[model samples]
Target: MSAVVLSVALSASASADMFKPSKAEQMKLGKQAAAEVRKKEKVLPDSDPRVQLVKRVGRRILSTFSEKEQPWEYSFDVIESKEVNAFALPGGPVFFYTGLLEKFKYEDELAAVMAHEITHVRREHWAYSQRDANKANVLLLGLSLFGGRRDVLSATDLLATFYSLKYSRQHENQADSMGFDMLVAANYNPDGMVLLFETLKQSSKGGKPPEFLSSHPDDGNRIRNAKTKIEKSPKEFPALTKINL
Candidate 1:
């Protein structure tokens, strides 16, 4: 029985290896999907002063953290919505909601949030996730073709869903860490990261939590992590010098 189990495990591992997609293929597919999503999404104008400010700050922070010699163009825009959310897609597409900007008490806090989202792109976290999803689908297809088992295909689909969700959470944590480092390197106040989380926690108290809050992990956990990092390496806050707002 032990030998049989070992043989089954080896087979599964080999199948998994065969399913993995190349990074180039994943990038092509991800860019195509992103283009479709962008068409449906409304992006704020670059001419807007607030939008420009975000870009300026984002560039500064990103320049410090990103070592990749490639030309990474960063675009920051304020979506015309009240949702307290910000997201960065693969290839440096970033959107920040007006509500999130209103919640920031300090510029550093805003920068911290921007840095966190930007890290998602810089680290290619989304690309990796997309690659993994494609790989899973490939594996499912192979199983259906070779094993001729409908059950295997169903199981693979379910596993892919779970894996996607799990990968999202992992990506969030990684961005958080990268953001912390980026903010510190740029000489921005790291406490701003904690403050942003505190704002989110407070916002969730009375009314229904926003979609962003629901999608992200607990604000308390994020705040705690930010605070711990801040205490270790505190940086002076920059003066409010002609903010675009």
Candidate 2:
């Protein structure tokens, strides 16, 4: 099957993934998962304060994006759960648990979460994961936009289950790096992101770790990476000298 290289707006040196799901397929899986989650999880309404906060922070991160060329549709939802977890469906559905929401003390911290999750969807990480796992139930169904009914259950499980949703370390790094750019582009303090990593590190319980942090063991490395980017302060922002963060 012929496939086009879907280049992501990350570091230019980062190699793009190929032969992944189409935009339509990813959207379909996302819609399917969205329906399933609404039925099974206690998703908060837009009227809820927490949900409102998430949307506000999510918009901040999203506003910095320049990829109107892509067909992905972004949606943010907050679920009433204590688990410190948040994951993104292939198309653009990003869910945040109440636990994660309550943990953030600043808008920047929340923006980091939104930025990271959005990056996963923007970069089509799930489609690449399906390719690695050979899970045709999720991959061949195509990480589409909507209208696909095939493997609906599998796609739903892929979004809700830890095993299916865990991104590889490399993908995690890319999301962090690219997400940093998004946060900075929005003119928010990038240090909040590093603070989030520290929050995760300090909050991990029982050595088991939350599903979100369990997949990647290198939290320290990610923190270091964020600091490095801030220190380097590329030409994108020349006022770096005045910004304390």
Candidate 3:
């Protein structure tokens, strides 16, 4: 694949109760975290085929954004782990585990995963989550000091837990929606997203579920949602194709 400059503009959206960090701050923190991960985790070398494929798809998906919109210096790395998981840090450090990569049989499938992770960073979900968690902690502490009752504290904990789960589910769905658009915008087949979900569902049949699925939307719901989007916007997507590295 020809090299493309993949970048995204920093989001300036406002939040009612969240303390959003500056893009520079996020990048710095992400770099620190990524460095620590590299030090402790067994990262695959660039020469590894898996790493190369990840970078290739990642760059393609990122190319959908303009170069002038550069806000995060995104980097992709592969981890030598058996757990089927992938994640992106605050600014732009994305990691893929070998187990997750092994499940991907096509480049488009890989692109779907990469695009979803990229959306998380682009939307600043982690920063928002952290701020929300901080608020919950403060609220809980205030309740503890004022209420001084076990039942009151339990109720607050239950509410906080509910809100966290709801917010997380919302984020996961948003990532899926945005990532599907990015996949198509990058010229990969949009069906790749739905197929990727199907693969995950199949993988979870008779054994422990993938770590990737732990925080994500239910597989059935995700697949149905993707299909609904494609059905709603048939003209927006190109003909389906199987893209292999």
Using TM-score as the measure, the top candidate is 2
Ranking according to TM-score, highest score first: 2, 3, 1
Compared with the true structure, the alpha-carbon lDDT of candidate 2 equals 0.72
Better of 1 and 2 by lDDT: 2
- The alpha-carbon RMSD values of the candidates against the true structure, listed in the order shown, are 6.1, 8.2, 12.0
Task: Please give, for residues 61-145, the per-residue lDDT of candidate 3 as tens digits.
Answer: 8877977756988999999988777888778999998988888766778888899889888998876775565445544443221
- For model 3, the superposed segments whose C-alpha errors exceed 4 Å read 1-18, 142-167, 206-208, 216-219, 236-245
- TM-score of decoy 2: 0.77
For candidate 2, give the lDDT of residue 30: 85
Q: Mind giving the per-residue lDDT tens digits that candidate 1 earns over 1-245? A: 35544454447556653333334433443354445445655656788766887888887886775365344456666776676777664566577877777777677878888888777766767556645654455444442323633223232343234223433667778778888888888878777777777787788777655433555747477788877886776466565333347
* Residue 200 lDDT (model 3): 82
What total of clashing residue pairs does each candidate reach?
0, 12, 0
- Give lDDT tens digits, candidate 2, residues 151-183: 344564666563346778888888899888888
Residue runs of model 1 more than 4 Å from their true location after superposition: 1-38, 66-72, 139-167, 205-216, 234-244
Residue 198, model 1: lDDT of: 76
Off by over 4 Å in 2: 1-19, 135-154, 160-164, 234-245
Lowest lDDT sum, 10 consecutive residues, model 2, at 4-13
What is candidate 1's local distance difference test score? 0.63
